[model samples]
Target: MSYPISPPTVSFSSIIFTTTAYLLKYQLTRQYSNARMALAPSAPAHRVVDVISYLAAHPTVELSVSDIARGTGLNRTTCQSILLSLEPRGWVQRRSDLRYALGAGMIPLGEAALAGLQVVDELRAELDTLVAAVGLEALASVVSGDEIVVVAHARLAGVLSQTVRLGQTIPFVPPFGIAHLLHAPDGTIDAWLDRARVKFEPDERRAYRESIRFAEDRGYVVVLDVEARRRFEQAVSELADRPASHAARRRRDELVARLHREERSFGPWTGSESAEVSQISAAVYGHDGHPVAAIGVHAQPHQIDPSRISEHATSVLEAADRVTARIHGRNPAMSARRPTRHV
Candidate 1:
């Protein structure tokens, strides 16, 4: 159920959500960004896409041949073959030490990639305005594979220091990423739940199914449990350099152990007068009925009066809608109140 939180003033400086001839453009734009970063394990052209994506995401580090093979789930021979073909073409550079990285040939391609981020720049500006207006830390991210990668963030010296670094990936596992998975296609949520790092009782699983949809309907997910969220963020902040690293896997396990213990932390708000919360995430979508990004606003690390929860959510949801409007997005009728899996 929606909470009785009071609305905030100055959530936006004369923000308006109106447009046309915008929907089609956003569908294409969303597709482009997803292609750039969010290929699932089962994506096609695995030999090329998986290796290229792994290298692109980890451009800061040079990797041994075995490292690339392990990271991309490719066999050693296939990985070696792909690298050999790409090294001559300059897409892959064999370092003096025999490790590899994106080569100079990727320079023009990288420049083009960065230049295609006008949409991301717009989202960043909007989030900046949002953080300033609400006086809270804020971030926006999009789904990539089985994780959400932070693309933009803004913070003030108010509540807490930044926990998760930009570009750090959070697993799309249960009890997290509810906001990102809200608009997922049929059965996708089921797959996510089935693959959860933490085990859930049947009751808990059923409730999560409903809660995700309910949040979709309300346009926001109230992130309660201050200490739990901080712990989760801190663990993520300390994650290994690459998500495929052994340390990262251990950290993901920590998320399930330390964070998911509080099964009561999320789900439909019970209208409690005070919520021990750290953030509230608002849903965002594209015109094609698929989610394009995730957005959230942070609050002080304490119990927030339920009325203040309402106030924070107003600004958060308004900012979300404005971002969608900027990109010509809408909640498709079919996706509304629709369950991602048949429970």
Candidate 2:
């Protein structure tokens, strides 16, 4: 048997002295760093960043300097100064009417950022394997600010799955984007719930919160279970499958408006029996531990097979871990085997 190694013991007075020395050193280092910062030229780069952020949020809208200043909470002169600096570099463009909007210069930076993400090809590979194993349409979506964009996918042949388009973007609405939202930074849920067109009831809000908690703890989210869920998924799936004609678009919008006013359809479920499982999603994390992607598998919305729920959740979790490894680490290794399926 291997003996437990013990840490070295230290005298009380020696510990006290060492602590004092460390405290003194820390104070001195902090003071020196603060002094250096104070002496350095102020770049006002943060103000520029805020302005760019504001413009990005309203990408299609041209704003006057005052509008930008109000949005950024910066003074008019400061906003003007920053815009002046940005205009020369083509970061922001001044319209003929003197209004400003985000310029084409940002395109290359956005392109470079997208190009730098070498995960797409690897993510698609993972989705293909996952779809094959789970026999459902497996999709990979990456978070982009307030939106989740489908980047890669593997759809099973002969399945009546909804068509998926690459680069399709969906807002982080309730009963959606939970796989990413569950691991999001604080305030994300509040923002998500608030984004709803209609205010949710207390029970509804609590249920949504619990669904996130379930996904957080269980490493997967179960979307639908009851027969009511089946009907709801069916309606949504029908909308998704609508043709791209103008009449279909208008009709879809009308139906979406009706659905938006209705109570959010999904939340956490607890049962010995299995859920219908319209869709199950697992989170993929980057090195920073923020959710980078969500790997989701769409089940037969009407099927209530209990066994597949457990099996499918495990497969997605494994796919998530492997995708996380390929993108964030050198080797494709999961830190742990997936938890037992039922739990």
Candidate 3:
């Protein structure tokens, strides 16, 4: 005869404690796994932003999935998925050749970003006044990181004008960029120059130093004539053409050296002939006493009589001051100072 076998008994409290412990352990493991996934390289949002940024940086280039993968360092499959997803939303468009580019959807986003800038809003009326008083295009720009971005502009009616698109990034070079550098803190300027690997010749370096000093003293920077403008454009074009490689960087240094040489020789102008064109730029300081933006006036000598450049410059300087005061919540009248004419 066999004795009946009974199962080992467990206490109700023990059972309850074991079950609760298991549940807690499971929940903690799940949370840890989720956090790891969120920060992983394969995170969906990170991949999407990487793809978009790659396209934006090469706006003119229509890139295939493989090209984007290589550029953004994402796997081809992920890049393709992102591109396909973005196509429906209009964030990225597919060309007939099946390459991708930034699509129409980005415009509204860019407009919204521009609308959010207080500086842009405050400068609108001042820009209009500046355009009217100087009879030229008036622009307000800010240094957004390492780039100069045009935030607002105004042009007088019934006059031919050059339209600088709002939210466009400008190359950090002379004429337009000098105002930013002149007013930037010393550390920022040094870091920017170092990143560019700039090696300036003695004379070119001296001229560059003087230009900054001149801008600081006069409260504005002037690009005297049309020829200087052409040179500036040419240098910018050359710099853009070169790739960001070691060899290209070497050539860039050489080109930058040449540009500085030319700029130093073409010092600020007090007056010009009736047919010449010139630019005046003044810094817009924030409440922190650091330059947050710059205001510029572009005038042909015929538009403003050569004798009246000083008056036009004064108007530009006053506009900049007014914007600065507005940013700091100070009275514009209390901040008024005599404009220092750049000779």
On residues 1-343, what C-alpha lDDT tens digit does candidate 3 reach at each position?
2222222232222222222122221233232346346422335654565576556646667889988887766789988988998899777889999998888766555545445567767876688777767667777787654557666666665554332434334445432477776556777665555444346555655566677776676777766554444544444333333222244345544554455445533355544454344667888877656677789886543344666667777888888888887878332123445554334
Model 1 Cα lDDT, one tens digit per residue, 71-156 = 87678888888898889988778988989987766555433543544445667777766776666677887765566666666666
Local distance difference test values of all predictions, in order: 0.63, 0.61, 0.59
Highest lDDT against the true fold, candidate: 1
Worst window of 10 by summed lDDT in candidate 3: 12-21
* RMSD to the hidden true structure, all candidates: 11.0, 17.2, 20.9
The C-alpha TM-scores of every prediction are 0.62, 0.56, 0.60
Put down candidate 2 lDDT per residue, 87-109, tens digits, no spaces.
98787899998899877666555
Where does candidate 1 stray beyond 4 Å? 1-111, 114-118, 157-160, 199-201, 226-228, 240-248, 300-306, 333-343
Q: What clash pairs does model 2 have?
A: none
